[model samples]
Target: MRKKWITTSLIAMFVLTFFAPLEARALADESGKVTFTKGLDMEGVKISVYHQSAPLAKENVKSLCFLDSYFLETGYCVTTGFEVGYNGSENSRFVSLTENYHLPIDLPATGYIWLETTTEDIFVEYTVSDYLYTRDVVYMDVFVPGQSVTVFGIGMSDASSLQLGEKIIDGKNIISRSSNQITFKVPSDAKPGGRVFQLVNPISNAIPVYVSPVVFNDPYQPSQWYLAQQQIYEAYDVFAGESEMVVAVVDDGIYLNHEDLSSKIWLNEDEIQGNGLDDDKNGFVDDIFGWNFLHGNKDLEVKGAHGTMVAGIIAAEKNNEKGIAGIADNVKLMPLIVCDTMGCDAASVANAIKYAVDNGADVINVSLGTSGVTAYSEVYNEVIKYANDHNVPVVAAAGNGDVNGGIGFDLGQFKQSPVCNETKSSDVIGVGALAWLVSLPAWANYGSCVDVYALGEHVVSTTVPIYDLEGGLYTAADGSSFSAPIATGVISLIKSAYPNISNAALHKYLTASSIEGILIAEDAFMLIKEQYTSADDFVAGEVSAVDVDIQAIFSDVPGDHKNVQAIIYLQQNGVINGYPDGTFKPENYVNRAELLKILVGGKGIFPDAAMYNNCFPDVKNDWYAPYVCYAKKEGWVGGYPDGTFKPDKTINKVEALKMLLNSQSVQLPGFVDVAPFEDVATTDWFASYAAKAKELGILEETGYFLNPGEEMKRASISENLYRLLTL
Candidate 1:
């Protein structure tokens, strides 16, 4: 076995010098201080200085709060750590640093920022300053544990400055330093794997805090991902569990008593439910359907939180008026509790996966990994390969380590990396954890080595031990261990939706359908389109290039009932289209170009050839040309400053309706005395839209009228279209 370590002495020298002078600095008095009586001069951007004791101090600090200083100029992500100046100096400003590892010009993944002093007892006082515009580069920490990782694009002053551990499996370079940051070069030899970086501050007893290189868990952005799962569900017709998909979880054991999970648990209908006889007689007595590999008994009893947690993530009853919704509301959970109360070994895990594949399981989710590579690994890998050949998908979690340091917090990296290696299998989808922070979780790992990212940090879920603790019930805990199951559940959904789809093709389809590919806006309906219309028009019939159905989304015709009258009015008005299936996709995202075309076309102002020309690099000549020309001609909409007119972007109900209200034709009376929704505030952007929609009788304030920026559904669009036509 090979061992890798980091040389702390070389980097420790500067860390000692950086904080030694903090004790000599004096307190910040009101004399030279510039305190704003009303409020200090901060630019338009939201600005606030955390006084260190704020509840979110640790989080804000980890996110490199001070990096906002340099970012004001570049609008790029930068982090600034802690810093201080000479005692009682005339000028005072904390420094923030960022090192561009990819290129000197591009944004770097991680770095440090000098925080404004807050504590007087502590010589440092990170005071917040005004935002400004300037161009300045900073340094960062680079951690390399293995020589196989190739170092690249480092702004280091000397190559000899490279630091090596006790064993030279690799060499790490500590590059330049600006303000309070030190930049390091990433070795070019680095492959898609885990690495660790460290930050050493002078604070005593706070051993050099190491950062995991994997700073991000879910590579998918939030705006694009919002309601993505719902969209996926909408794309496919709902298929009940009995239809033909079975999700097998190789974990501790499942609670057959849990309401949400109980009904959906896979049962060998061929055999009796609780008969002590091995009706099928596979091996052990009463081997009803699923077996317990841990206890070596035919009890088939539900005992721990581990199996339940994993099961819940994959297939807890959804909308059944019970527990929290699982990824698939209706999917069979074939529980194979192989791990004991403490944990399990390679042999048991391998056998469990093999059992799932040998049996009727379509998708196998293994939430456990080990440090040892054994002949059983061959069995597991072979089983994974066999599952893949048979069109099954295996999802695993990337080992949690100092992704920043290339070492695990407890066991260190490289000791046992099952996810890193097993991912090589075509059937395996290795997942990494992402902290829930909006951006820059100092601890989340990042690298090409990771495939898809999901919410992993602080993730609360069912724990196996908690089951025994709560008496055969449920409890919640947090870990990447729990996240893998959600992904597994999502896979089960995809499989259930398209039973004949190959595992590889299903993976592609899921990735392609990922909402992360879409761009979201304040208006829920106006999401940006990620697909290129030029490619093949539409990969699927539901959304094609030539035409989109916007009507047929309602049940009760508008003229018949007061509630649905407005809905029909909009459709009659040509404000919306119905699908071939006679359903209106009212709530669906209204593409920007499509909305503009609808509005201009309704106004009878179609654009000509000359007006159809656009200047954006992304737009094409034949695509939405007339709509673009007409919108620009009518002053109804404008292109982004970059000259791009993103047409496929979805328009929210508020923005779409506001544009309608803004039209020269539509006139709405103002309401001085109208009741407001409990959730809608007067300061909301869509307040006027809501008010106007109510007066026009297009929307009823009594029931529901979601404000601006809320996602618009196909049904809502149909109703609005019908109302417009009636008006």
Candidate 2:
């Protein structure tokens, strides 16, 4: 058998990505920056229905934060000062001061500027210097009337003498104070209407915040474990939805008239239903709700169970004594059939995405995946990215189990098309299936690329009456496919509440709020069996979790260590070693040299030092020279921008993932219009790399920020490698 050798070139390709210089930012001495929006730049601002505020073109909208660097965001969904959770149909979102909306060119560039808002209007305004934007004093929030609520945007910690629409909320009512928020109790007598908050000690002009009661009375909501696991209930408690938030379901077909889904069907106002003409002038003829891209006709019968199940999971009528509750209480479902009994193809799927974007879909759910399809299609990825560029987020399934049958396959094993296309499109949110609440379901196609996970086992959702139905209203469905709609439903709800939230920010919130995916070490080890031709080549002895005594080897990894099995496997194979002090600092960060040694030694690669001495100007003829030079010669490692490879420095998750995937020749996901991470922007160099890493399941972190520059801890590096190994 050929020696199990890890190509040093792959590590070299990733080595250049490791030493990313963190720019030291000047300490901002400024306070909260606010941007007074259009139609509400003064106190008691009100607008007449006839007021035709100049609408800013979507492309021209710009936002500025620290360093005076402005980034473009669509005017339709740009961040504004008014963060109200009320109904959103703001037309003149263009601003007058600062970043969002349309900032009038004539407004004062700096210094004190009064911002005023009324109970009728909700928006944001510039507070501090134009440079800093850390705070906004008061943001739109619901006052629960007697219960303490967190008003998140206020920056003033010493702020006191609070008043909600002339109702004095004394300083004593303040429960706690933090940098970004001040939790305070609302007056019991607070009326149920929009109220502007006022505070003394560094006065702040605030937006109108609507306070009202919110609740979900769906009878069967309690039975759905997915809702709780995904924090759907918590999201609904804060923001309500509207019918305007449309989520297009591109599937084989949906039961358009299902009892629970009938009312939620999106009606095309421009098209005359039953009329054979292209009444809407958009595209298809008589496309009242959604068109069928498959047969080229509008025969949207429930050809299969998947579409209806997906639709119900997205926007089934809620609190209507329905079979079960959807993630979004109020959302419109545009059922566009792009598949038939033969299953979905590239051309039709692309058309469906284009249709959804053009036809006013706030979110798109493609709860489908290929079982063994390995063909590449740029058209499929382009359309997915196009929708993302147009502010429509597409949520897709990671996969059911294996790219084969149910045996199990890792997306890392090869390339997955459509679902995670070649570009690693930031727009497509690949959702994995989580079973038993915490486990990444065995067949979920669990890999380095799935963005998030949701309950996908034994889920109850609306199905056609002709099929297997539960209570004659719904059926029990299972698959990672269902997970897409679950995420889409949440996106629909959020889009309606914060109409100004861009798809990028919406994506950030979605993934950041996700339950972190997990894979125990023993299971991780077992899953990697397919990666190796022989069991002895992978692990020496039995694969059971009970056999490994990690403490006996490293004296640091306890029996309960999450990665104990992996550590044992690596240590026993002569891959990794403890410190001379006889302790394996699992929590310690792994540096470039240590990581290369672990991986190279694990793979049993023995490079001829004389032939591989000169790797780079920085990578000298040291202990790591053989691995670096060998990889460099093999075209695995590329020199950095500065023409040097810093193999001694530490690396982050993104660099490591990019190196591993690139080295293995794993097909990376395609380019997306936006970067999903809050801290990583579209223009960042590591944006696509980071996104690709995320798609390949190399980065399993769930949060707003990727913290891409932070050092990779030893255990995290092990977990990441293990993920790649099993993937």
Candidate 3:
């Protein structure tokens, strides 16, 4: 909220202002004066200038021009030439010329020169210039071979003459050509590898092209509706999870030798297996696979069915013709047994958390909660805090108290447990169970504290073997307990893919990417797809840190700008972009089209435009048409009853804030004694948004005014977007 002033120096000011007049003069000739429109003296090695609308004594006559005097401080001789061409529409002629000069090595100044023509006199000023370098290139979207796609050469001068890798195509290959898009077929023989498609006309350098192949090859993936529903399959196509990251299932015990789970279990390489000694001494002796906090040893034998099932949800081996596919295909599961048949105590669970954190667990899954314990205790809170301090995410289950459609069973309303307390650290994600991947399960808890919902009703996963006559090893169960692990698995996938990502960022990514309301399976998948794809642009899995250069993404955002970091973060995450020039234009006010695009793309709230019926009269065929249509379809934004979306109009501060809050499904807080802002009245349309923004601390309290109807600037929106993402 603090303002930072950016000042331009006097030398820079002189260059910009003084160069403008010279550039303008180079374009036009006024008052019958023969002037050098480019500059008084050509300072650069290579220079070209145009004398516009100059009166010529005779048409189509050759004019000889030369620099009157020269003293070279540098080595080469000065050369100058001029050519006269008709101005076409007017009787006046234009003279264009290139001047090349060299200075002697010892001379301090280049001597002045005056030009005398047969009919006129021209004045020349002497000044030393630096060399100029320029490269001409066209931008185009590259596609996979054999696909007819529309590619836009946004800044290309002559798009019609564009060629693909120096090869020209026939008319049959060209679908259509317009000012904006050039629809063409990529030749079947176009090889896929590097992105280098050259343009013939205008002589552009090689341009980058992107091509992605759609592939799904998991053997048992078809049976796992949950994976496809959440679009984990698409995510896998980009990043199928990594084995380097470990997810610790802090629960009862896992069936370590299960056919689907045996290969994927975490092994402490430092500790010798079955050594019966304190090998890699952290605390416990012979903790090979994982520690058993319940028995106080490394015996990981399964006593309860819950832990094994939870472990399978996080990581069951994939493509081994197994019973089911876990959310992550390449993650290592550390089974830390904390309970037996009776359930775990605070002390035992805390120890398990410590064990997981000390042994390099990137993520911890605590699917069990103390249902009888209510208040925050040092024993449990300290351990959870250790995980938070170590940058490990702890996923816990929201207690299952739903009886009558989650009416009185909300976690916020019920304060009956310790581990599931509302006062838990924000690092701990409390997950609620959803039936049919949409509604809250009959036994699932619901509340504002529950960060997200996952499919927990009748969830099928690996379980401990029941050796009776007709029993199977795997089974289907229902509870928030199961949902916690599912959410944990998803987090594990993200963590594995982005190993260096902070715990806070991981939490934000998961919650922000989660689908709201009755989450449609396909919609959830789209959200996951977006997250994975957005993250793909960033460098991941590096040993050190990687900084994303804002200039690489947005040309207008200088690396030294105050808000450049926030702008780069949002831009890399696909949150915002209003211009095709690769410039963010941060000083410009945000428009309705831009806002809707950010909400839909960044928040992952609305589906693609193709899924909804078009209703906005003014948005059809517009660049932001899809976002506008999606917003209207979801009722996040409403148009006039007459059916129009004035998308180009600048969005006000209140309207922008409300749409952002609405996109995240954040509810406005109840009335309080203090008003949110001096300008916001309770009866106003955006009063709730203002109040909620204040309640969330999104709007600064000190020296901050709610300029309600004022247009929101791009820089202001970038800051707000950072808040929304980090929230």
Candidate 4:
């Protein structure tokens, strides 16, 4: 009876299993839900459940384990086992099963799992996988997968040699190698999950690898506060300055061999080095790079740290993998040493000015100044005048003397000798120091003489090795000395971007486009704004509209004349004037008296009324008597051999050019040839002057003849004079 019962039960089980296939097929047809759970704080983990090998719904899961141990493989999910039997042939018996898992963590560990299901429910197979501890991992805030990253060890004992999962890192994986760091280009198959790197050289430990989205490799760019303040980087995005522009540093000797400055130093390719002869024959002998006026020699060996610092501020090479960037990175630094330990002499400064102007320097920086040397002093004044006449802008320090009467002594009530005077304002930019970009430094000289304000206090730049206390081949300095160079650098950048810009236009752009409201002084603030704003515009080749109205200022000037605008400009600026009848007398010849007044008045310099005691005896109470006396005193005019003033004498063309050029105390280069002029002879007294005028573009010939002996009409005078001022 028991055997009969067992047989009956087995037959019933076999009949039940055979008929259960229909119920399983109904179960497989019904859609099922999949739930996923992960350790605490384990975001981006995904699990999917599929039916018949079709993609199903995916669920993001988090773990319930402690956050600290989330990276470790903790068993947080309950597991159950179930069995299902196959009733068909061996190959077609089993149902297809696949578990798709994904984790968002960078360099996540992956493993396989097994699952079983019965007709009633499904079960999950659990397997242990590696974990990444956040504390053990060193990484940047963000990174793109499959990109390169430079990594250095933080707390790991042996970071030099590393292994990613059993794959030993070698030259194939590293893009570059250094003593303490390695740059690796992540493999293309790298997944966005936590990864473990084994440090195996000095000690055994697992280091987590994290990635950042971006990287900044320059070591010192972040510390350049002045560059940031001036928005130099933004300007750099448009233009980094051109290499052809040359900026002359007329300061103490510069460190020519500095790592950051050596490549940017101006080399005189036309002249041979150390030849002990004037190879180029401009003036100084053996000026291979630039002249050293202080020693009267060719050697640019740094005797003081001032020039080096100024040169670096103007142009220390950029993207060279070291040091801070200059405002104009591509500019050439022409070091014109004008000072030594004894300080700069007026003669040396003057010579340096001429050197910079005669050479290829596009900008001249005078970061040195005398405190009490009156602005009218001929010592440095003549050189500055020459620079102005040649269309080369000269930037000078407004003296270091504190005019506010603070921690330092003032430059006296009448400070900033030479540069502070009214005469220099037209061409010389007197710079004052600012602590930040907003406020003036306590020691910086201010007042009407200060043309612009620049970051000078605590300014960091390259200096001589002996003076480099910062150990990085650079040092921090302060004063108007640095501020002047900062302005020079800015001007150099503008000139580089717009090589065709006239000096007057360049000056206008710099003053007109500066930022406003930041500086203590209204003019200084405006200038600052102009410098920062117009630089990018100039680089973009944007032309600013002319704001001054020429036709309205001078009634005597005809609209048809070629220099009507220039004449109006001069008249509006008080440099020239019309006749008493409201007529410019454009067709009349300019008399000696009128010429003297125009030249003397153009500089904005005037002799004291009491000092004009009728030096010229021709006409004591003449209409031009005062001007004639002033001109005589200034050595700009003289009487005839018979001691006659000749106030109404009509000046000839050659005479007019000579007087105008001489008014600026300009010394022309040696006579080359007179071929430009058809009538002028090489042996004529004014031959060199005519040649210089042609070379300077001051005398544009309307015809083949240059009537040197003919009296110049008022129109020709105005046109040529405008060219002289703008050239």
Give the higher-lDDT candidate: 2 or 4: 2
Q: Give the TM-scores of the predictions, in the order they appear.
A: 0.43, 0.42, 0.44, 0.47
- Ranking of all predicted structures according to TM-score, beginning with the best and ending with the worst: 4, 3, 1, 2
Best by lDDT: 3
- Which has the greatest TM-score? 4
TM-score of candidate 4 relative to the true fold:
0.47
Candidate numbers sorted by lDDT from highest down: 3, 2, 4, 1
Give the Cα error of residue 531 in candidate 2, in Å: 43
lDDT of 2 by residue, 92-170 (tens): 3322233223322222222221222221121222222222111211111333466565543333476666677778777
Q: Cα RMSDs of all predictions?
A: 24.6, 29.2, 30.6, 24.6
| Lowest lDDT block of 10, candidate 1 | 1-10
Point out where model 3 deviates above 4 Å: 1-223, 369-378, 402-408, 416-425, 467-469, 517-727
Q: Give per-residue CA lDDT, model 4, range 332-400, as digits (tens).
A: 888888777766666777888788877877788888744333233446656766666555788877766
Q: Of the candidates numbered 3 and 4, which has the greater lDDT value?
A: 3
RMSD of 1: 24.6
